[model samples]
Target chain A: MQLTNRSKQVSNKEMTMAEKMYLPSIVQGLAITIKHFFMKKPTIQYPEVKRYLGPVFRGHHVLKRDEQGRERCTACGLCAVACPAEAISMVAAERKKGEENLYREEKYAAVYEINMLRCIFCGLCEEACPKQAVYLRHDRMVPVFLERDDIVYGKDKLVERLDDRYVRMNSEVKATPTEPSLTKAAT
Target chain B: MDLTVLLVKGLIILVIFGITLLIATYSTYAERKVAAFLQDRLGPNRAGPFGLLQPIADAGKMFFKEDFIPAQASKWLFILGPCLAMLTALMSSAVIPFGDSIRLAWDGTNYDIPMQAIEINIGVLYIFGVVSLGVYGIMVGGWASNNKFSLLGAIRAASQNISYEIALGLSLIAILMMTGSLSLRAIVNEQATFFEWNVFTQPLGFIIFLTCAFAECNRTPFDLPECETELVGGYHTEYSSMKLGFYLFAEYINMFVSSAFISSLYFGGYHYPFMNAVHDGLTGSLGEIAGHNIATAIGTVVFFAKIFFFIFFFMWVRWTIPRFRYDQLMNLGWKSLIPLSILNVVVTGAGLLYDIKYTTWLIVVVMVVLALTSNARAPKSQAAPQRA
Candidate 1:
């Protein structure tokens, strides 16, 4: 009839003379506290200092730019489909004539948004993006925002502001690691 | 007293009062810092660099806070309580000698300015009387609150202070028996060196006095009245704003005064090891005027160092030990500490009469054995709780 056999019997054991005196135990406790008093305090100043996040840390999403200074997203809608929280949404637009400098492809997202409140930062969107446009950047993370609307990150907040040459150099190095001469020539 | 003496005395009184107040204010900061350190965390560092201006910020906050009074509370008595607490706390410092007489040159002649506010004859008795009166503040504040918790806390505080006072007086009697004087100055003079300190002679008595002191101060381990778990802020539950600040300030002031008292009574006051030799050596090298002043300064520094150490120890114990249950506290006060202190008085008397140096050791040994055996033979109700 017993629900569980986990309960142990409580012992009403008698205390020894030393234990009864209470002085020894108090002294022992005092010694321990003093030891801690001299021990190195492990306090992080926080804002001025930060703990090193691991390499695999998944942070806020970044809508990346290609080496040619054009947006990488082709409005494939894969990232939105992969977003488990349904946080990502976008309005696909057709590229107008002479808009080749702005859009990398004929199809581009005119209005893209991610509701940060709903995002779990699981990096699934990054993995689902075929164009390598959406990435969880290691350098930047979600900032604390007061309003719910403020946390909804737009392309203006998410896009990288690196120079075109730096982007070209970085992409050349990452893409053609086997061809050192090509990367050097690209840089 | 002449005008010069009166002015000097006035100056000393003002300086001591300011220092006591400053120390009490900063002790709140120190308490948090120490507590934080013990728990491996950083305490308030935002007010100013290292939180140095925390007390000033706190004072400002308290001043601006809305002063609340319960509708059912007795307003006048509630106000009187903290004032009485603070007054009694500061009054004890009047009898405590801060340092030996400082040689001052004025009007083409030198004068010796004793570092006490008032050199009262009955220093010990004055301290006892003031301490006993302190309970009235807590009781009045609690009763005036018109709250059940406050009333309960006040009753607990009243009973605790009264019970501990007996043990406290008895323990002091042991020291008085040895010193043969009621004056704190006399007690200090008796123990003019480290070895002569009453702490060595009356270890058991010191232990008893210290335990009772914790109770008297309403510090942790004996802070049953204000214990958060049971009483919910205790006597000061209904208090708010500057009134609450006053109660807290009074507690720290009491702690500061008690530290000085303990140091004066048992730790040889301003006396250090080889103090006389150092003074004589200084005088032998430097001229008497400068040498004497320097020695006094050193002694003053040493006295303050001892007081700070005791204050730190008080905080250390507070963080280390948990509060005692009400009944256990009562039992320890009435049954154990009182009887032990009584025995301590008798033994100290007998030892002093015999003029035996080893008698203290004998008494200490006896005390240890008696305590252990007594606890072993104690009833089940009084059996020691298992330590965590």
Candidate 2:
């Protein structure tokens, strides 16, 4: 990179009679200020008037679910691996005989946690999730907490309720080829 | 004084005092609002709708604050400082006439009540004395604080007032020459018509007087005494709580009274164009007594409107100009204003002696020449630099 000289010489000439009087310039300055006085004040009164966030806004994380009210995460650990801050952690578990309705496939995440303090909202986990089990919510925000442990979100907080709007939107994930063939898996 | 007259006078004084206090309170709110508006923002809207009750809230806060004095401070003088400031500030308003006489029909006996609190013969002189006494408030407070910055601020204020007071007096001399009386009432009567305002006759003097008034009030660009950048809080650096509030509050009161003085002295007081016509018309339609009251009411409103304009002008100028450098302030006051004022007096005196109408024309001619010559001499090559 090339650096360029940015400084310029300042003139030190004495003020003329007009400049000395100062009334004319003062009058002009006043006129400008009065013009601004009538201009629209660009203030957003917070809380009552929430500003629009763009569609691509990355906020809090949400664990997705399939149409059958089953967890979509196969515990492949790709999202955990992709998280730059090492914020994501989860334990894998094999689905038992009676848990067929709960688990979409043989493998499911038993305990998923994300430390919100460590998370930078970079959406890398969402990008890395091949099965599309986790995505950053556009509308929701990570609430501040006083205690460090409180900020580390567990599966109870991370997992979206089946009735949530995002979960209904994610119900389409059942059609994806990544989901196991249901009849074969059931048998 | 007769018992009834004394009672009436006392009541009028009370009413005027209340009005002055109320106006001074609201002036603080107005100053903030105006400053905010100039910067394209809303100011203090949480206290009440449009922040109408802001002064009341501010006073409450001041009252509730813990009044503290510095460990090594002169407690008595420190306490006395702001009291003197406020007392002197309120005192000057007594001589200013808010309106013409109003006839009151009390128990079938009509008595004419004048709007001024005290109709002293030397009204202008009394005001000047009271205003000069304002410096004591600053000096005492700053001296009592035992702080170097406070001392510096006190000194700046003292010198600034002394310098500007000369120019102030000189400029008023020109007005006094024309009015031929020191009584504020007589001065107002002289300018009984709109165009006959001393501003038209003594434009140069008016400019000088206005400039001096800014210095006297310690407002920017003459506010070197309290320029926060240089002297912390200036004279009030050691002051806290309601003691500090008094110094700050007195400033707005001073602004109010000076605005009143400016309106009364130069801007035709309560005189409006076609006032006599309106009064006559009302008198013809209504009875003489009712018409006179209405006319006086209109005059009072007009007078207040003038005062408000000047107050707004003060705020406007504040938001526009930067504070003067100490040297520049001294130069402006002593070198420029004083000389110009002296010249104004000489010219006005000569013009008055020759003919009354000649004085006005001469002033106009002089103003035009000065403006044109100054404009012609401005450097041709200096273009305003473009922003990066």
Candidate 3:
């Protein structure tokens, strides 16, 4: 029934006068702290310097667009359904004939919102999307919200702009004009 | 005293006052910085460059905080507490000789101005009296609060100070025996050379004094009175705003005065190695007046440097050692330090009769032999308990 070798038997024996003095131990402790005083500090000054989060890091959410820069989402409720935190919500609207350039499909999301406070950043919504519409960006994190109202992100904040698009570093997906996906979808 | 002397004395007092406050203020910042460095972290760099303005920021915060007092607290004594603490802390620096005298010629008459606020024959006694009075501040504040915890803390502080003061005084007696004077300036002048420092002659006494100083200042390892873990802010629990600031500031001031006293008493004060050579060279090159003044200036700077080192040492020990238990603290002060200091005094007395150098060597030899014998007698390793 012997335990691990690491267990130390507590000594109840009388301490030597030297041990009782505590000066030697105090000197040893001071030496340790003085050594640490000169050692390199591992603190990273935040705001000025940031540690690199890996490519798979789930961060801020983004609503992507098609090759032609049209909204990729077809107002599908799958993401909202798949969200464990139930953070995502949207309103579907049928696309008008004149707005074909704006919507990639016959149906589009008119209003999309995600409560950042509730969203667990589990990437479940990203996995549930039929089209590659929603993704948690690896590069940027959601800025800290100051107001309660600011915690709920709307389409205006999430939608990807054509000029400055969100690109996944590890993915082969691109928005080149030579791509035939838009024509295939139209046909 | 004439008008010029009065003016000079006034100027010196003002300078000393400014310096004490300045050092106390920066000691807070330094304490934080040192604590951080020891713990391998960068502390307080945002307020200003290297957080140099952190003390100012802290003072501003203290001033703006709402002044508070417990309803059950005695209002008058509560107000008097921090004032007394601060007053006593400031008063102790008056007799410390910062440097050699500055000679001035006015109205065809020569006058010499000592770089001290006031010269008193009983400087050491004055310092001890002021330091002892410092405890009254804590006691009054704690008692006035009418809180059980505060009262306990105050009691602890009072008892701790009283206990350690004996050892501290006994340790000083060894030095006094050597120098034959209680005046701090005389003590410094006695140790005019590097090797002649009291630390060399009375190493045992220096150790005891240092330990007692740490306890008397209510620093870590002897800081049971204000220990947050047990006493919940301790003696100043009921104080708020600038009153709390005053209590905290008074501690730093006490630390400053203690460092200065330690420097002046034990470490050769303004005297440095090869000071004679430096003085001679300066005087030989420049005229006597200019050279003497410059030398004095250097000595003052050196004195300040020693004080700073001791201050840093105080913080160093704080960060290094954990606080002592109440019983352990008492045992060390009453049992260990007191007896050791008494021994130190006897040894110093004996040394004065014989050769001091021989006596010091003998003590060292005895201590080494005792340590070796103790190590040899210790059981090598107790066999591990047999498993059930």
Candidate 4:
């Protein structure tokens, strides 16, 4: 085990009478403050301005649909398995012969829920999804909630529209690039 | 005619008051900016012109802030603290000599006016009295908060003030020895030549006075009350929004007042080089000229310039140094500085007896030595540094 002696130990110690008065030390501190008076300020003016973001920035979540305007999730339980917070839940339904257009495949989610309260929004579920269905977008999706319950977003909230016009507008990730599939899915 | 003069004087006072309030506001901005720079970080640059408009923005923020009053706090005392702090901060500026006097011309006649709002003969005493009273602001605020930390902070502030007040008064007694006048204006006039500033005559006294002033103001290196680490916002912990803002504002104002006092006392308040000559020159040129009023006005400007420079210096010192421990702070004030100041007086008295010139440098050197010697700290048994 590491020793607590390191915590108590003061390295590089030798102080003069002048250092003890603390005047010169204080002066050194002042020099730094004085130096900052002329330094460049980093402030992004809000509303009228926005800072640029990198690729794969997961800001806000949106649902994605296929070219035929079908929901992308296969309801194979991939996203729910990946979610660390246990935020994603779904009731899978077996597609009948006449229900081919309702889902991308034979399985469809009869009920889907994402507990926004439990979700830390780390986007692990988005990474875990084998079907490239879930995505966490950049920017503060919304301001931190006024009510505790307001944070828990559900089925109507989580899905993204995978349409050509919608994908064109949100192609570039503003904060962090999550994965290569996000770009392909957008395309 | 007197009524007209009164009206004019009132206008000038109003203008000066406005300007001082404005300065106080901006000084807060400067304090933050300085702190930011010292820490190698950017501070408040959002409002306008590299945060030039920050004071106004801050004022807006304060006005709109949640004025929190703790349920446990004494309601009357809670309100009383910031009120006293703000009032006392503004009151001292009234006696401040802003610039040289200006002539108020009506038709063919011009009347000479004192640049200051009031020119009391006992200006120095009045200032000392007022500043000493400034302690009540912190004391009342801290006590009313009803928290143990707040009460502890108040106690610290009260004791600190009590200690430094003595040193401040004693240091000035030495300067009073040389100037022989309590009138601030007179003191400045006596040091009209740039070379004859009191800092040269009584450098030891000046250092002592300055050190004591910093202590009195509870500035860093002596700031025991709001020692953020241990106290957790100290006396003003419960104060939210504008109330806390006022307490913070008072600190800057205290710095400003100390700067003014220092400039007036030692650096020659409002007195400029060749001021007497300039007065004579102008009078000769104008045939009775605009006269002494103009000279006084010039002196006033010079005085304020010096004060602001010191204010800037105060901010500089604040950003530079960490605070002293309570024990160390008390020890320095009572033990080292007090004895050194007494020694300074004794030395100054002898030098005066001998009628020596340039002995001020000797005082400065001695003070430097004494300060250095006292700072000869003992070896620490506990290698860990505790929060001051």
Q: After superposition, how far is residue B54 of candidate 4 from its true place, in Å?
A: 5.5
Specify the poorest-scoring 10-residue window by lDDT in model 2 chain B: B357-366
Residue A183 displacement (Å), model 2: 27
Instruction: Quote the lDDT for A130 in model 3.
Output: 82
Ranking by TM-score: 3, 1, 2, 4
Give the range of the ten consecutive residues with the poorest summed lDDT in model 4 chain B.
B378-387
The candidate with the higher TM-score, 2 or 4, is 2
Q: B163-254 in candidate 4: lDDT tens per residue?
A: 98888888887777777788887887778788789888877778789989988888887888888899997778778888888888888777
Clashing pairs in 2: none
Weakest ten-residue segment in model 2 chain A by summed lDDT: A178-187
Error of 4 at B302 (Å): 4.7
lDDT of all predictions, in order shown?
Answer: 0.84, 0.86, 0.88, 0.76
Winner of 3 and 4 under lDDT: 3
Docking class of 2: acceptable
Query: Which runs of model 4 end up more than 4 angstroms from their true locations?
Result: A1-21, A36-58, A62-77, A89-118, A137-186, B46-87, B137-151, B228-249, B271-302, B353-357, B366-388
Grade the docking of candidate 1.
acceptable
Order of models, best DockQ first: 3, 2, 1, 4
Task: Select the stronger candidate by TM-score from 3 and 4.
Answer: 3
lDDT of 1 by residue, A72-178 (tens): 78888998999999999999999999989887889999989999999998878877877778777554578889886797888888776655222222332232122
lDDT of 2 by residue, A107-161 (tens): 9999999998899998888888877688787667788798867988999998878
**How does residue B295 of candidate 4 score in lDDT?**
68
Q: Among these predicted structures, which one has the highest lDDT?
A: 3
B205-283: candidate 3 lDDT, tens digit per residue? 7888889889888899788889999999899888889999999999999898888888888899999999999999987
Residue B221's C-alpha lDDT in candidate 1?
A: 90
Better of 3 and 4 by DockQ: 3
